[model samples]
Target: MDLEKPSARRQEPEGCLVVAIRLPVRIVALLVVVPVRMAWDALVVAGRFLNDTVLRPLGRALLWLGRAVFVWPFVGLWRYVLVPLGTGLAWLGNVLLVVPAVWLYRYVLTPSGHACAWLGRGVLAGLAWLYARVLTPIGHALMWVLKGLGAVFAAIGLGVFGALAWLGRYLVVVPAVWVYQWVLAPVGRAVSAVVTGIGVALYWTVRVLFVLPAVGLYRWVLAPVGRVLAVLGREIRDALGHAWRVAGRISLAVGRFLAGLFRWIFVEPVRWVYRTVLTPVGHAVRDAVLRPVADAARSVGRATRQALTAARDSVRQARADVRRMLFGEPRQREAVARREPTGRETRTLGSSTTALTKD
Candidate 1:
């Protein structure tokens, strides 16, 4: 049997069909997902850029501010407070350990057989006693040797004193007296005579050679000197007088010129300044400062004078009052004298009364 000719149409496999559907789905999903993934990635990149540009800078600024505010205080607290406290704790722990060790050493090991303090005291006492006992014989021997040396020295000293006394009389005193009388006294007399003779000779020689001749020479020389000096003095005086006349003329001319210049330049303006500015300013300053001071001084002087006068018057018045009070008024002065006793009269009467009473 002949088969019919197969047509050119191809049949789709089931797997291929399924694969095609899945591929479409996957392509669509990928197409959508790619853009979403890209957008997500862009968002992540932008977020990172923003964070790097803005958030990082802000964070750094905040961190710097935090450090500025807190770092020094924290460091100070750590260094000054915490560190010291820790060191103190460590030192206290060490001290606690050492204290007990020292205590144990002092209590137990210092004197292992007895109480340490009493044993130490007793040992010290015994050492002192032994030292004393050892030194005693040495001290006695030293004393005995010193005593012998002293006795020897004393004997030597006594012998020396006796020898010196004898030598003073024999060697020094009599020799000194004999030398004074023989050598010094004769030498003094000879020297005095030689000196007197030389003085007289010199006086006569100077009078003859120097004084008389010098007077003649001076007189002879001074005549010519006086003549020359007089001429020179006259010449100098004439020259000085001419120079003074010239200087005076020149100075007057200069003064006239300067005065003319000053008058041309300054005198009128200066007069105005003196009248307006300088005079007023000087007067104001003087009146404000010096005048007040002068016034105050004058017032003080016047007040002082017045006070002195018042004091004098008060003293005088007081003296007069006292005199009046003591003596009463002038009218009663004679009465007062009469009432008071005279010393001579009272003495005479008392003498008579005493005589009569005695009789």
Candidate 2:
């Protein structure tokens, strides 16, 4: 038929049918929807962010910044500079006041020493007064507050728990304890003792009536059956072993048989035909077909060689005749033959011999 039809169909597998479909519209749909979906998702994210973000303001941010700028500097100054200056002034005053008193025995109540000692005593008295008046009272007040709170909580807990416990004892706990002691405990013990007695009796009955008989049956009957089964299993195993060995031998024999059959049916005949029939037929065909060609080639070669020899002889004869007419020589061929068999003479003699053999 037409070979081009199938090849054309194969090359343009989707040409017209694919083009007729609205492929461009589908491509446009895909391209347009991707960006629209991305834009919609972006809007959703922005709306979610705005839901929380729209309420925050600059006031809280600036409040912390303002504290850092104003309050932190004052804190640093008081801690690093003001505290050190105050401590140094207090130390100088203490040394000026107390040192003179400590050395009063050496000064012997001199006015300057007395004044320094009095100042030191006054400073000490003032410190004691400040501690007694302010710090002691503050500590007492804190202790009183903590003690009052602890006592109040203890009283409340004791009262509420005492009332609830009394109520529970009256309503639920007393009756439950009474019932357990008088009813459930006695009943449970009696039932448990009875269950134990019955279980003991059942255990003895089964051991005496059923278990002993079953054990005796297994010892006498089942054990002998088991021994017989084991003997049968051994016999079956030996039989299977013999069958397996025989199967292996059969497989080997089948493989040997198949090999011999293939040799006899196919391989030997092929070998015989190639050696005895095809070999001689090939030789005979070569003799029949090629020998004439070789003979014709030899004949053509002989004819060419003879013609050349004759041409040469004629030319030589003409030359000799001309020479005789002029200078005279008739023994060219004889002289050539007597001189020696050169390449030209050898080739001519070989051609003559081949021609003679062919004839």
Candidate 3:
């Protein structure tokens, strides 16, 4: 028995129109895109080379120089100069503004605030007493007088309101209700029925005259045309994309050939010269000339340093001798013994020095 591998997906059937359109479009696109792809690859290679060879080093050097020239000086100013200046200004402000303000608040403003608070409390107490003893009684008496007058007015108002309600029912309300029930109700029903009929007829006429034809035109004509246009667009896009990718592969092969040619022609020879010619020449020059000069300079620096040391010693000896002759030998200072033991005379674990543990 033979086993067949399962297919990942099924292929769609293509029409003659799609096959005809795809081939020519892809051919033309390939012709147009090959040069552009090649040029793009060349630009990418040049940008990479320029970045590695020149721009990266230049940017690093500029960054270091900027730190030295601009950034470091500003940092030093902030750390050493501006920081101290700001601290001094802060101290001065504390002395001039903060200290005095604190003093004023503590000595002058605090006492004045206390006095004002006391005065406010006394005034509030007096207002409270006045409201309770005098104003409250007067207000209650006035309210009692107003209540008696309101009761009398309310009785009069009730009588007048009842007469008005009786007159309104006969003169206005009853006539309005009779007119609505007998005249307006039938007229409104007739108008509403006529509007309902007209609305129904207008809806059916619009559906037959406009809506059904629009639906049929869209379904039969526009939708099919739109589908055909969409298929064409999709095919053209796929062809262009396939052509671009094929062109890029061709461009890559060409680029590789050119790069190999350039390396063989230029880079190999320059590398050979640097390795074979320049390296030997530089080593010979360093051994023959630079090494001997460096040795001689080191010898001269050693001799000069020794001579300076001897001269300094001689000057110090002469100063010492003159000072001894002038002062006629200085008296020796008397040594006084300290209570603490010296390093060699340190107490062992078995030994004791305190009064309670003396041995």
For candidate 2, write residues 1-359 as lDDT tens digits. Answer: 11111234334343453333334434444454445554555576678777667634455677788889998999999999999999998899779977776678566767777899999999999999999999999999999999999999999999999999999999999899999999999999999999999999999999989999999999999998887666556444544444444444554566578779999999999999999999999999889988888999999999999999999999998987888998755566554445434565454534653456633
Model 2 clash number = 2
Off by over 4 Å in 3: 1-10, 52-86, 197-209, 287-359
lDDT of 3 by residue, 1-359 (tens): 11112357896897887666666766776788788888888899899999999999999999999999999999999999999999999999999999999999999999999999999999999999999999999999999999999999999999999999999999999999999999999999999999999999999999999999999999999999998788778866776677677778898889888889999999999999999999999899989999999999999999999999999999999999999999878899999998888785566787876778865
Number of colliding residue pairs in each model: 0, 2, 0
Candidate 1 structure, TM-score to reference: 0.28
After superposition, candidate 2 runs with Cα above 4 Å error: 1-157, 170-175, 254-258, 261-266, 286-359
TM-scores for every predicted model: 0.28, 0.34, 0.72
Q: What is the lDDT of residue 193 in candidate 3?
A: 100
Local distance difference test scores for all models: 0.76, 0.74, 0.89
Candidate 3 is scored at a TM of 0.72
Residue-by-residue lDDT tens digits, candidate 1, 1-359: 21122358894454443433443444444444444554555577679989999999999999999998999889999999999999999899889998899899898897784676777999999989987999887899999999999999999999999999998999899999999999999999999999999999999999998999988887899877886666556444544444444444555566578779999789988888899999999989998999999999999999999999999999999999999999987764344456534665454534553556643
Q: How would the candidate models be sorted by TM-score, starting from the highest?
A: 3, 2, 1
- What are the C-alpha RMSDs, in order, of all predicted structures? 57.4, 43.9, 6.1
Candidate 1 residues lying further than 4 Å off, grouped into runs, are: 1-148, 219-231, 234-238, 247-359
Q: Point out the higher-scoring one by lDDT: 1 or 2.
A: 1
Whole-model lDDT for model 3 versus the true structure?
A: 0.89
